[model samples]
Structures are given as structure tokens and as C-alpha cells.
Target: MAFVAMGVYGTLSAPVRPLTHGWTLFFFVFNTAPIIPMLGVFAALYATAATRAEREMEKEYQRAENLLLNILPEPIAARLKDDPHLIADEHPSVSVLFADIVNFTETSGRLTPPEIVQTLNAAFSRFDTLVEKHGCEKIKTIGDAYMVVAGLPEPREDHAQAMVSLALDMIDAAQEINESGQFPFSMRIGISSGPVVAGVIGERKFAYDLWGDTVNVASRMESHGRPGIVQITEATRGHLGDEVQIDPLGDVEIKGKGRMRTYTVSRGFAP
Candidate 1:
């Protein structure tokens, strides 16, 4: 249409020229016609590139979000992303479980460094799965010891019961790993229920951890517990109803706390 308009205009204003009108129309069409399509092509290319870049950015953001959630709890991670402040909370009633791989130190001495790490990873990975299954938070792993908690950042009425179920599953998982001949070891688990201050610490590594006497006692329970048994503090045992079976370990000497009676999970989940 532009070429036709230019042709008619050039002919009407030809000024009696011979080939000038035709040349003028040809010049306009030759130069201007290609440019419009070229501009459209460039615009299309830019739009496609921009859309692709946006999708890539979104994917990258999602990957970062998943990594953050893996490091911290979901609610805590969301809060950190929004406010980057110090994340801390105190829960009056929660169950903390600490499980240590039996004879890991001695076993590591006989194996190479890679072998030791692989063994620990395999065992802890299984424990991580169980943590997800029981709706608990795995705080961190200190050497061969794994720490997990139930009832907060979201509180539940039966935190101790959940921990007991998790502990029982962990024992069976460790046994399965041992039976596979990948790493032969047992787990000594301890549970304590009480108040705890949980938060995300360390600017560089950013570890989500717990602090309080309850955390301390839970660690002690794991350290002093016998392998292949799930030990629980009297407080934790009290939280469990008749649905779970527990046997008293009697009054035992705890390092920080005086003689406190503890119990062990006698059987797996009843129902």
C-alpha cells in the first residue's frame, strides 16, 4: 500500500520528468519496505529473548528458594527471605530427639575419609526421610549425632509420640543399612520434651539450631544411651499415651541434671 501510494504521488508530482517518478517510487519502496519488516523482526527477537530471560530468572529464584527451605524450616525460610532478621522462637512444649550412630568413631578409624563420609551420609539420609515422614524438623548433625525436633516451628499436641515413632523408624532404618553391609552400625536415640529456644545462627554457614536445658538433656540422653535402644526422658515418656509402649530405665545419673528416671521405647508403633 505504501509503494502504491508513493507511486501515485510520485506520478502526480512528476514535473514532466521522464524516469524520475519511477526512480523516486522505486527508491522509497526499496529502502523503506525492508526497514519496516526488519524492525518487526528485531522486535520479535527482543520479545522472545526477554521472555526466555524472565523464565530463566524465575527458575533460578525457585532453585534458591528450594535451597533455603532445605537449610531452614519453611516458615523460617520465608521469614528470612522477607526480613533477613535474626530468626528465633521459644516453644514451651516440644520434643527433641538426638540420635548418635553407635561406634561411628571407631568405625571411621578403620575406613578412609571418603568411606566414613559416605557411611554417615547414607545413614543420615535415611534419617532425613524419616524426619519428613514424621513431620519433624531435623536441626543438624554433629559428627555422628543427628538432632531432630517435633512440635515447633508449628506446635503439635503429640510431639513426643511423633518423636517416638520417628525414633523407632530410625532404628529400623539403621538396621536396614547395616544389613545391606554398606555400614554396619546401630543408633542410640534419646528424647526430651520441654521448652527450647530455636533459631537460625551463623552468618556464613547459617545453621538452624536449638538451645536450652532441654536440648542439653536430649544430647546427654543420646550420649549416655545404649546402642539399638530409643531412650526417653521422664518428661517425654509422660507425653506419650498408652498407644506407644515404653519401659522405664529407672533413676539414672545424668551429668547436668541429678538422678532422673528415663524410659525406652519397647516396641514400634502399635497402630
Candidate 2:
């Protein structure tokens, strides 16, 4: 319409005036028409790139969140996110369970490094599932040893029972793995229920761990325990009901702590 109007005006005024207005309008459109589409193309490209970048950033954030959750408990992770300060808590009653593969060092000697890792990974991964099933928190695995706790981060009345159930399930899982003939191994597990000071340590590689006498006792229970059996402290035994069957292992000498009565769960109670 502008071009038509300009053409008419130019024709009508050609005898009296110059056609400067028409030429100016034509030159203006000619100079800017290509640039208009170029600007739209540039804007679309920028928007697409921004959306892609945003999605990539979101995916990376989710991956980091999953990694954090895998390392720390859900509650602890949330707290750490809210406050960067040190995270520590005292739990008067909680059950700690530690399990070590029997004769793992000897077994590893026969197998290659990759085989050792594969076997441990397969076994611990199964135990991880059982921990979740029993509503327990798996602390960290040190080589062939697996450590877990119950009634922490969120307290529950039956912490000992949960640990017992988890131990039984883990034993069964190990047996199944052995039966498969893929990785044959036995596990010695120990449980201790008492007060423990739990906290997050380390800045670069964060670790959530437990301390106090209870932790030490739990470790001793596993170290001194018989292969393919679950040994527990008297404190932990007190928490169990009659429905679960337990056998007296008599009094055992635990390092750091004098003689303490320990028992083993022989049978009964299936996970």
C-alpha cells in the first residue's frame, strides 16, 4: 500500500516536485527487508539454544541430586542442602549392623581384580535392596564389609527388629548368590543397639558415619562372629521379642570394652 500510494503521489507531483519521497521509501524497505528476517532467524536460534541449554542444566542437576541421595540419607541430604554447616546428631537408641565377607581376602587371591569388584558389587547391591526393604540406612561399604543402621535419621521403636530382619535377608541373599555359582562367599554379620553419635564428615568427599562405643562393639561383633551367622550384642538381644529365636554364644571379650555377653540368631523369623 505504501508503494502504491507513493507511486500515485510521485506520478501526480512529478510535474511540480521531485520523487524524493518515493525513492526514500523504496530504499528504506530495500535496505531493511533482508535484515528483518535475519533478526527473526537469529532470535529463533537463540531461543532454541537457550531451551536446550536449560534442559541440559536440569538433567545435570537431577544427576547430582541422585548421586547425593546415593551417598547420604534422604534427610541428611536435605539438611545439608538447607545448611552447609556440619551435620551431627545423637541417637539414644539405634541398631547398627555390620557384615563382612568371610575369607574374602583368600577368595580375592584366587580371583582377578575385576572379578573381586564384580562379586562384591553384586553382593552389596543385593544387600542394598534388602536394606531398603527393611527400611534401614546403609552407611558405607569398606571393601568386603557392609555397614547399615536402623532407627536413625528417623527414629523407630523397633530398630533392633529391623536390623535383625535385614541381617536375615542379607544372609539369605548371600546364600542365594553362592548357590548361583557365580560368586560363592559367606557373610559374618553383627548387630548392636545403643547410643551412637552420627554425623557427616569430610568436605570434598562427604561421608555420613557413626561413632561411640556402640559402633565399635558392632564392628567387633562382626569381626569375631562365625561365618554364615548373625552375632549380636546383649543390648540388641534385649530389643528382640520371643518370636525370634536366639542362641547364647556365651560371654565374649570385646576390645575397648571389657567382657560383654553376645548371642547369635540361630533360626526362626524369615525375611
Candidate 3:
């Protein structure tokens, strides 16, 4: 429109009034015709780029949220997002389970590093599934040792029972892995139920872990446990009803706790 107006103005303002030349009108029409379409093209490009960026950013946020959930409980992870300070809480009762792959050193000697990791991953991944199935929280794995807990972050009346079931399932999973004939391994599992102080520690490398005498005793139970057996503290045993079978392992001199009784549990309730 501006170009047309300019051409009309130039024609009318001439020393002698004359009709606008064909070339002048054609020039104005040709230039003005593309203006709206060019603007639309640029607008479309900007919109597409913005939308793509937004989707990418959203995807990144989802990935981060999943990673956080993997590391900590949902409630705890939400709290950290709000304020990542010291996160410590005392639970009156929570059952802790620790399972270490037996004779890992020898297994490593026989296989390459990648092979060792694959073998460990296969076992731990199965344990992870069982942990979720039993409604337990996996604490962390220390080399071949896999740790988990129940009745924490969210408490339940059946925390001990859940841990027991998880341990039994884990033992079964390990047996299956070994039965595969490729990666032969046995698991020694320990469980204890009592008061514990749980919290998130470290800055860049954050870890949600448990402390207190209960944690120590659970570790002792695992270290002293027999291979291919689910060794559990009396505290845990006390919580188990008639739902499971147990054999007395008698008393052992725990490092810090002096003498303590332990037991081995079956996969299911006694007939």
C-alpha cells in the first residue's frame, strides 16, 4: 500500500499531471506482493523453533525428575527440589536388608571388568524389581553388596514382612542367575529391624543412607551370614509372624553388639 501511495504521489506531484507508468505500478505490486508471505514464513520458522526448544527442555526436566526419583524417595526428592539442605529423620522402626554377592573377588578374577559389571547388573536389576514388588526402598549398593530398607519415607505395618519377602525373592533371583550356567554366583543376605536414623548426605554426589546401631547390626548380620542363606537379626525375626519358616542359626559374637541370635528364613510361609 505504501509503495502504491508513493507511486501515486510521484505521478500527481509531477510538473504536469500524468498517469502512473506501467513499470512504476508493476514495481510497486511486485515488491508489495511478497511482504505478507515473507512475514508469514518468518513467523512460522520462529514458532517451529520455539516449540521444538520447549519440547526439548521439557524432556530434559522429565529425565532429571526420573533420575532424582531413582536416587531418593518421591517425598524426599520433592523436599530436595524445594530446599536441598540437611535431610535427616529418625525412624522408630524400619527393616534394613543387605545382600552381597559371595566370592565376588574370585568371580572378578575369572571375568573381565565389563563381564563382571554385566553379571552384577543382572543380579542387582532383578533385586531392584523385587524391591519395588515388595514395597521397599533400595538404599545403595556397595560393590557387590546391595542394601535396601522398608517402612521408611513411608512407613507400613508390614515392613518386616516386606523385607523378608524381598530377601527370599532376591535369593531366588540369584539362584536363577547362577542356574543360567554363564555367570555363577551366590548371595549372602542380612536383615535387621529396629530404629534407624536415615538421611541424604554429600553435595555433588548425594546418597540417601541409614545410620545408627541398627545399620551396624544389619551390616554385621550380612558379613557373618552364610552364603546362599538369608541371615536375619532377632529383631527382624520378632516381627515375622507364622507367615515364613526360619531355622535357628544360634548366637554369634557381633562386633559391636556382643552376642546376638540370628535365623535363616524360607521363601514362603510354613505349611
TM-score each candidate. Answer: 0.89, 0.89, 0.88
**Error in Å for residue 144 of model 3:** 0.7
Clashes of each: 0, 0, 1
RMSD of each: 5.3, 5.9, 3.9
- What C-alpha lDDT, on a 0 to 100 scale, does residue 152 get in candidate 3? 94
lDDT score, candidate 2, position 221: 96
138 Cα displacement, candidate 3 (Å): 0.9
**Model 1 clash pairs?**
none
Please give, for residues 1-271, the per-residue lDDT of candidate 3 as tens digits: 9999999997678556444698769988899999999999999999999999999999999999999899999999999889989999999999998899888887789898888888888888888889998889999999989999999999898999999898888888888888989887789999999999999999998989999888888888999999899999899999999889988999978986799999999966666
Residue 136 lDDT, candidate 3, scale 0-100: 96
| Model 1 bad stretches (over 4 Å) | 1-19, 268-271
lDDT of 3: 0.90
lDDT of each: 0.89, 0.91, 0.90
Q: How does residue 106 of candidate 3 score in lDDT?
A: 78
| Highest-lDDT candidate | 2
Better of 1 and 2 by lDDT: 2
